[model samples]
Target: MERLSKATLPAAHTDGVTLPPSGWDTQRTGIVHMGIGAFHRAHQAVYTQDAFAATGDDRWGICGVTQRSDTVKRQLAGQDGLYGVLERAVDHTGVRVVGQVREVLFPAEQNAELMARIVDPATRVITLTVTEKGYRRNGQGGLDLADPAVAADLAGGEPVSAVGRLVRGLQARQRAGAEPITVVCCDNLASNGRVLKRLVDDFCAALGDDDLTAWIASKVTFPCTMVDRIAPATTDADWALGEQILGLHDEGLVTAELFKQWVIEDDFVAERPAWEKAGAQLTDDVEPFENMKLRILNGTHSTLAYAGALRGYPTITRTMADPELAELAAGLITEDVIPVLECPPGEDLPAYGAEVLKRFSNPALAHKTTQIAMDGSQKIPLRLLSTIRDNLAAGRNPAHAITGVAAWMAYVATPEANGLPLPIDDPMADRLAAVRGSKDALGIVENLMGIEDIFGTDLPGNTSVHDQLVDAVTALLP
Candidate 1:
């Protein structure tokens, strides 16, 4: 069987699959994106493709950068950056070929070429989907200099990691005459753009680039964004579904639910795609939307993940089916999360919470519990802890919020029944693993909270928070 590639695209059409129009075939690189994963492809890339189609602007095409490994790059390169996005519905799945990814480059491997593209004047906007951990931020949202990878990047040259590459690209642009650009963060963290901006500034300052920092300050704008799309990892089943339906074998196939959303700050220093034209809401302050999402959607999602994983449910649908996981999610949202959220205009927080549960209950999108459960150490701060801290500050017991954290602790401490360690894919896996070494629930709670980045100094020292977490964790233990 022939593998999917640009050469195979013409003949790749099948009954249920949709091919890119002639317009998709002719797009120029305008935006460069970091982290070419399912979320990026199914959400941002599809939006950009539609934005291009809507505006007839070929210059806004994406040049996706795969930061982790060459897996995505190899997958897309064979397809000439062409891929199919299957919008999975309860009844059926529909596939559309997204071609806005004009090129895919492995940043660490193709350093010079990657730098060249980023520094290119045509690249007016740089967007990132490199999750919360990619920032390597400490408790206070500054660069975690103690991190070995961060320290190595600081000591080295040629722009290695995400921050290094951005700093290097900005430095190049600065040298070539300060070019105005916009850097947007599409990650789920709060105030994401500001977070990335601060990290980049910290990275530059640590490397002693005062002049470059100044230029970046004057010429660049980092727009905070809130993006929502439940694009799960593409399993082999998703792949086979695509092949059986479309008759097109695509290595870069991705899958997502029928719903999509993008809320971006209207702040930009240079020209950006009319993403708003493609069903994205452009606003001035993303705080309300950002907090709503982080607290409600992400908070409960993690709740189901850790708690559901403990129950041995492999995917989200299975978890949501259980009365326990479902109640945990609804209770977390209604009791702990919703009270803290300021409903974005025209949005009812309660109704939104209901809709989120409805989306999670989608039987077709088998979002793996393990996938959402990864990075609990990194995710804990924003997803659960923020709610925990706020409710405590407001003089309410944060017991409901503590359940997710407790579940995480339980999940980490006890592996699957096979004597194999549960797959805890966190940047702080070693730190968490050590925390699990002690079977004491309160001790584990105290240790995890004390981790400055995860809980910050105040929460760990807060006796009430520790008490609540312990109680929550104790309830989960068999």
Candidate 2:
């Protein structure tokens, strides 16, 4: 095996393939990130690198933490925290290794060390992409204090949940009289900051301490975010293709589209890097952009995730190639979703929608519908249901969004889709099955909408929208 070293690797993809050095520095930096997934690496870390390169200030270098997966930690360490990212598009592939990641820690392997680093005053920003289910909330949408891991953590005087760890880490920071660290959530939740705030409060309250809560309320900042990028999974075939193109053995390479966007509410309490230099939009109000992206791009993605997966499609590229699937996806956006979106100033919703469809259809990406559909129950509320509710409030029915939900239900109703069992990775999977087992689709809709935590109480009572949803869903069957 060729020893992976930046010195031996090609300088750029154009000159063939190259691997980054296997001994990059792992010194501490300003940012400590949780959930070291591909999206974070290709999107946020890429942005950080751009900012660093532009500003020449390495203050925002990232130290990544993975709660469950050791794969990222081990692979990154093996490559000296230097991994390559391919900017995949319909016509091209641009490969480069991002060195912004300084170090990685697995909670299981370095719990003490991880906690200490997060609590360190040097860590100014602690960001996360740990997924929705990682929050461990209950039916009431509050933190699940009854979760076994939570129970274990509390009983053993240890922190288990991400929120728990964050709160505990903050408490340590507070005890040391450190400056406040901005806690940014890069998840797909609407009002992500507020959700994180609630989790922080719930976690602190569970500890039976008002002082800690007060300290956090006074010190920490949880800024909600809207991030966009189309990062497909790294399949074995993709690896082989990468090797064929770039004559280097890569163990931790990820493929993503060249397009990317990160919109954040400029609400951090402490000092922050000049991320604007790196193309991040730090606006006073992120609602319009958030709403637009959630509805048009993410909402349409979810629609295809279930619908295409059910119709014998594995990847978005293949699904988009199918005339019927592609037409349905486009119609769902232009006709049903676009009318409901409120774009920010200077942003063309139609143009943005067009770009999203083009990205989804990009032949080089091979983005999988199954991957997009993994956490349907958690994602539907943010991406689809919110728009449905908004449309209903405006006295307009969201037929396409409703159809997407119905397709999602149909996808969940049967484990196997076109001979393969789609991997369902949602916290409410069992509950969704129980709800779907009802007599009709309306019964399932009613049961799902009745979850006050997910939709709030106002939506389930909207009889007209309910009737319209039932009607649209009924028409979807054959």
Candidate 3:
């Protein structure tokens, strides 16, 4: 069997690979997307391929950008921009592999070239899945204008943060009198489009350049979106499977749940992909969808990630295989989560929760606890805290949400589980560790929430909330 490398690999985007006869391959790319992670490949790239297949519009093909990671650059470049998506279910893996990415840019390799690509008048859309912490935000959830890298970008007259990069790229296009571009944020953040806009505006404001901020606000359309796909971190098992099946060793291979969805605000400037034709809901508002996913899917995932890991479980599948954790998760979702969510017509939240559990419990997919647990500080507010806050405001019982919060705190306290050291990987890791050790859990909650940018003014010190969370953690302690 041939190993996975360009020399031995068959030509992709050809070779009988059933890609849609859309404008993707034939049309010049008009979209440049950042953060070439697994989620992007499995989710956004898949949708773009679907659109091309449906509309025969190749213009939506992606040019991926990575600020870091030489691994993706090497693998994608090696395979002629070919990669595989392993859609996992309980029974089998549905494999769809091809090349929808025409090119990739490594920031360290071609910073100026990357910026030029973004500024290209031909580029009509810029999308990002750069993760929550990639925003380089301050504690208050605003862009950190004081970040040295950003400052250097400003000093060197080029921006570095995702939003900053978009601003600079758009600035160049604006100076060139180019047409407006749509900036889509596909991260998990609620109202992510607005978050990107606020970050970009803040960056411009600190630069004392009203002209640039105004230009960005006027020309760029940052559309919020709800994107869902359970793409587990690929393991050696996956690579082995790929090699056995495809006669290749692909370092860039990604595995995901068979279920996938993208809900976007149907507003774009200039030309855009026919993604709506590809099963993506292009809507006037994505808030309902976003809220439902965040509170239900993400919230339940976090609960399992922390609580299950503490119980000596590793993968989400293994965790769900544990009847106690699985039942606890389902109970929390059905009794606590679903009641709060307004499911789409004909969409059953309970069924979705069951699907979530099934996806989490796929033994073939070893979605690590540490991977899900990374950036807990940045994640807690968006995933768990907001729902707790809303429930409290609405005079609803928030016991399960509080339990999730406690699990987060407990996970932080005991940084390792299942013979693995817990990943206290966050900007506030050191501080959180110190607080975790020094203060009581309640104090830790208060302190964590006290960070104005993270928890806002109202959430951290609520006496009732604090009491419930502390009590939950105390009860869960072995």
Best by TM-score: 1
For candidate 1, the lDDT comes to 0.84
- Model 1 segments more than 4 A misplaced: 10-15, 417-421, 461-463
Model 2: per-residue lDDT, tens digit, 147-193?
88776665646666787777777878888888888999998777788
Q: Write the per-residue lDDT of candidate 1 for residues 212-317, one digit (tens) a residue.
A: 8889989999999999999998889999988776667888999999888899999999988888889999988899998888889998898888887777788888
Q: What TM-scores do the predictions have?
A: 0.95, 0.91, 0.92
lDDT, candidate 2, at 44: 92
Q: Show the colliding residue pairs in model 2.
A: 6-20, 6-21, 10-18
CA shift of 338, model 1, Å: 1.3
**Cα lDDT of model 3 by residue, 1-478, tens digit:** 4434445555333322333343333557678989988999999998888777777766666789986676788888866677778676667665577568888888767778877887777889999999998888887668787887777777756456676676777777778888888999999998999988888888788778888778777888889999999888888877766555555656678888878899999878678988888788888888888888888888888888888878877777777888878887887788777776777645778888887777777777788876888888788787888777777777888788888888888887775555767668887787777664433666666666566766677766577877887787776553
Decreasing lDDT order of the candidates: 1, 2, 3
